[model samples]
Target: MSVTRITDVSEPLVAAFANLVPQLSSSATPPTRDEIADFLAQDGVYLFTYSNDDGAILGMLTLATFVIPTGKRAWIEDVVVDEAARGHGAGAALVEAACEYAHEIGAKTIDLTSRPSREAANRLYRRCGFVARETNVYRYGG
Candidate 1:
């Protein structure tokens, strides 16, 4: 029912990630408890979870923030809502939370990338105030 940043790792969070990772990326494996703990411990890396009133986690997202010569920057990554919970506004809530955090952290801009084939998600991002940009996003390797 609400979005909150995760500061500690727990079995419920571990299990939720196990269920959500594949939904985010078929080729990516879910992180273990220790891995999640390590990630949470990293500076400027944040993990937020959206859970129902009964404490059932329904969606999650990562917000990474950093400072450089230009200014503060944030990236919203790996946003995914549970398949059954898609239409109930969890994705929008998660995104709004991240954007608020980005503003709090003084980030001038927040960025995210979605595959063109994910039409619904792309539309959601646009509706959430992200503008499409013409730029090449190059990965270091395949």
Candidate 2:
């Protein structure tokens, strides 16, 4: 599979997001196809899709960019692979593409979060050369 940023039409990503939304959290709101398409067109967000030679999407990774006094950074968001495509390295490939994009854009670091329940995802992150870092992340939803 090959990974490329989403642009033009992104129906595949919308479908993938639909599959992932329910798994994220019970309260999480699912986005419509238009929302996914719009987000893909936004600045500083890298939405990469993994597709087979036949041009069928198997997985996707969304990297949100941040600019702070510390430096430029990338936060990986909503990485998901179709249930049937998990073991073929699609997830890793998507991450590799994101990292490469980060480096290309002069980002100093990249970060991602996984719950303790997601053991396989944590393993994949470690295998992708991501080290555990101590930091506090707080979220407030209105």
Candidate 3:
């Protein structure tokens, strides 16, 4: 399969997430078709899928780009490959597509995070040229 940048929502895309998102998180629910459409309407947001010739989506990732006083920035989020598809370069392809798109949009740098428990993902990140930063990442949720 190959990476495809998605601008609109479809039943297949929604179904793809139904299968893919749960593989990434036990508590997370997949995005609805409307939600996907609304998200794509926002500026500098991208959703990419890796699908085969027969139209099976095997992987997906989201890229968010924005500008601040410093410069353009991009973040890759929710990267996941089918459990059966891992180790076959699908994740790397998704990441590479994100980086290429972010660069085309003028992002100075791209960033993503993976839990240490996700050893395979961390290794994939390193293989894709992402460096680990020696800094704290804090999050607050209400």
lDDT of each: 0.95, 0.84, 0.92
Q: Residue-wise lDDT of candidate 1 within 74-123, one digit each (tens)? A: 99999999999998899999999999999998999999999999998998
Residue-by-residue lDDT tens digits, candidate 3, 1-142: 8999998888899899899999989999888888878988998889999987788999999999889999999999999999888888999999999999899889999998899999999999999999999989999994
Model 1 has an lDDT value of: 0.95
Best-first order by TM-score: 1, 3, 2
Residue-level lDDT for 142 in candidate 1: 75
TM-score, every prediction: 0.97, 0.87, 0.96
The ten-residue window of minimal lDDT in model 1 covers 133-142
Indicate the worst ten consecutive residues by lDDT in candidate 2: 8-17
- 119 in model 3: Cα distance from truth in Å? 0.5
> How does residue 64 of candidate 2 score in lDDT?
91
Better of 1 and 2 by TM-score: 1
lDDT of 1 at 59: 100
What's the true lDDT of residue 128 in model 1? 96
Model 3 CA deviation exceeding 4 Å by range? none
Error of 3 at 126 (Å): 0.4
